[model samples]
Target: MPRFYIAQPLAIGQLVSLPEAVAHHIQVLRLAQGELVTLFNGEGGEYGATLSDIGKRHVSVEIKTHQPREVELPFGITLAQALPEASKMDWIIEKAIELGVSGVQPLAAQRCVVRLSAERAEKKMAHWQGIIASASEQSGRNRLAQLAPLQDYKQWITQQDMHRRIILTPRAEQSLADWARHQSPQAVTLVIGPEGGLSDAEENLAIQHGALPLAMGPRILRTETAGLSAVAVLSGLWGGM
Candidate 1:
């Protein structure tokens, strides 16, 4: 069945028009009236609906039954990722959504290559949000992951208050396994640095903010790979995967 993300509350037997972008997709895919489709309200639930009409500029659907199912992780995982190159950031957001991250924070660290002004950050966040939406549709996720506004390293660290916070570092003596042994946190925040990784001062600041330095392995991973690896490990440990 075709799946779509809607911005409004969905109730059974209610008639609703698809968003403009989704309308175009329905038309191009030739989804006819009376065809069944799945719709999510980005509120962690899905609805079963039938295409009721295809208008000139919109497509309408009649919601039949709501599937009260949510594919959320047991423990929330937020990725505080240092801004990478343009294309790599896009890839990271898409995969992060697929892996069931609750939220993504684009951070500007000492070694970050990409810089975003306030206006540019808004635009980039919007672009990354679209990537997340498409990834949710592809990955069978009903709720859309949140994309936090851009923040510099210091600001990002100051704002986080997660139960467990881990910064990915290759030289850290503590492995993730050691950190997870005694602590059972409701929410976990994982920070991954950019291409050049986190500077010493930045790492120390994160530690000051209650973030434990964790080594993924002996080898160094790219900025894009580090978050996904941590997410996968954490999700499995928390019984989400």
Candidate 2:
């Protein structure tokens, strides 16, 4: 069954019209009336519906049943990544959602190559949010991931975080898998550096502000790979996988 993210309230027995983009998608896909589809509103669970009406530029569905099911991880994981070059951040956000991350935080670190001004950052934030919804639909997640506005690394580091912060770096003596194995499952905010990695000063500053440094492995992963890999490692060890 096809699944979609509806950014509104969904209830059983309610007849709902999809947005214009979704209507267009139904047209392009040639889905016929009476065909079943799944819809979620990010509040929780999912609704089962059938395409009740299909038009040239309109599509409506009658929600029939509700399934109180969720595939979220038991522990919340937040990816706090320094901006990378080009579209790597997009890839990271998509994969992070599929991997069951609860949130994404983009940071502008010292060695980051991609610099977004206030205007560009706003556009990027909106763009990344679309990725979150799309990824949620594809990954069978009824809830959407939280996307924090981009923050400066220095400023973001000084702020207090409720979840434990772990900075992934090559210099850390303990590997993430090792450290995670010995600990109970809990929420964690992962700090990943940019392409050139976090500067010595930035890493030291992170350590000063209660961020634990941990290594991925002997081989250094790229900016995009490190965070995803760390999430995978945590999922594997922490029983979320």
**TM-scores for all predictions:** 0.95, 0.99
lDDT of each: 0.88, 0.94
Show model 2 residue runs off by greater than 4 Å.
none
Q: Compare the candidates by TM-score and give the number of the best one.
A: 2
How many clashes show up per model? 0, 0
**TM-score attained by model 1:** 0.95
TM-score of 2: 0.99
What is the Cα-based lDDT of residue 218 in candidate 2? 94
Clashes of 2: 0
* Tens digits of lDDT, candidate 1, 122-228: 98988998998899988899988888888889887876583577899998998886666666746888999999899999999889988889999888889999999
Per-residue alpha-carbon lDDT of model 2 for 1-241, expressed as tens digits? Answer: 8898899988889999999988887788788999999999999999999999998878999999999999999999999999999998999999999999999999999999899999999999999999999999999999999999999999999999899999998999999999998999999999999999999999999999999999998998999999999999998888878
Worst 10 residues of 2 by lDDT: 21-30
- Segments in model 1 whose C-alpha atoms lie over 4 Å from true places: 181-185
